[model samples]
Target: MVESFHEFVVHRSPALCRTAYLLTGDHQLAEDLVQTALARTYRHWRRVRDGNPEAYVRRVMYHQQVSWWRRRRLVERLEAELTERADTDHSEATTLRLSLDAALRQLTPRQRAVIVLRYYEDLTEAQVADALGCTLGTVKRHGHDGLRRLRAVAPELVDATAERSTR
Candidate 1:
C-alpha cells in the first residue's frame, strides 16, 4: 500500500495516464480523466489503502468514462488542419496504423475498452472482465466481436501477407 497520496500519484500516474489516454483517445480528456480518478482515489484513500488502490482508481476512470459517453448526445467532430510539410517517409506500416486507428474509432465504447484492456494492456479475459465489472463471457464476446469488426474494417492490418499477396 502506498504510504501517501503524493507517493501514490508519483508512482502510478504514468501508467494511469496511459490507460486514460487509451480509453478516451484524447490527450486533454485523458489528463482530465486521470486527475478526476486520482481525486476520487484521494477522497477514499484511507478506505482503499488496505486494498488495491490502483485498481480502485482504474475502475473509477472506466466508470466515469462510460458515464461521460452515456451523457454525450453529440458525436465528437474532430477537424485537424494539417499544414503541408516536405515529403516524409510514408511506409506500409504507417498506412496500416492509420487504418487501424480509424477502424478502432468505429467500434462501440465497450468493445473498444475490451480491446484496449485485453491487447494493449495485455490483461487476460478474466482480468479484463473484473476490470470492466463484466462477466468472463461478456469479455470474450466483446473481444471476439471487436476483433471480427477490426478484421472486416481493416483486413490489411489483420492479415498483412494475405492482403499483400492478393494485391
Candidate 2:
C-alpha cells in the first residue's frame, strides 16, 4: 500500500503541482499545497486507495486552495508586489502561459478553481461540483464568470490562434 501510494505521488506530482500553480499563481505555494494534499491522501490511503485516489487528492487540493484564499489576504498583497518582477523574454507559448496565469490570478479562487478543473483537467461540470463540494449550478456559474472575466481582460486571447498564425 505504501509503495503504491509512493508511486502514485511520483507519477501525479508534476501535473498536480502544475494545476496548483495555475490555480494559485505561485510556484512555492503550489508545491506546498500539493505536498499537503498528498500528505492528507497518504493518511487516508486505506479508505481512498482502491477507488480513484487521484480524485481524493484533487478534492483535498481544491479545498486547501479555497481555504487558503479565504484565510490569506497577505497572499494577494504579496502577489501584487511580485507582479512587477514577472517580466520575461521567453517563447510565445511561455508568454501566453504567463499572461493566462496573470489573467487567472484576477479571478476569484472559486472561479479559478472551476476553470482549472473544467478546462485544464478536462472534468465535466458535475465532476467539478463533486470535486468542489458545491452544487453543479455553482460550478457552471463560476465557469461562466471566469471565462467572461478572461475574455474581458484578454480580448486578444480570443484571436490568439489567428494572431499566432499571422506571426
Clash count (model 1, backbone only): 0
Candidate topping TM-score: 2
- Deviating ranges (above 4 Å) for candidate 1: 1-3, 76-94, 160-167
- Per-model TM against the reference: 0.80, 0.85
Query: What's the distance in Å from true for residue 6, model 1?
Result: 2.0
What count of clashes does model 2 give?
0
Please report, in order, the local distance difference test score of every candidate based on alpha carbons: 0.81, 0.85
Question: Can you write out model 1's per-residue Cα lDDT over 21-104, one digit (the tens) per residue?
Answer: 777878898999999998888888989877877778877898988888789845753332223567965667766655656777
Scored by lDDT, model 1 comes in at: 0.81
Clashing residue pairs, backbone N/CA/C < 3 A, model 2: none
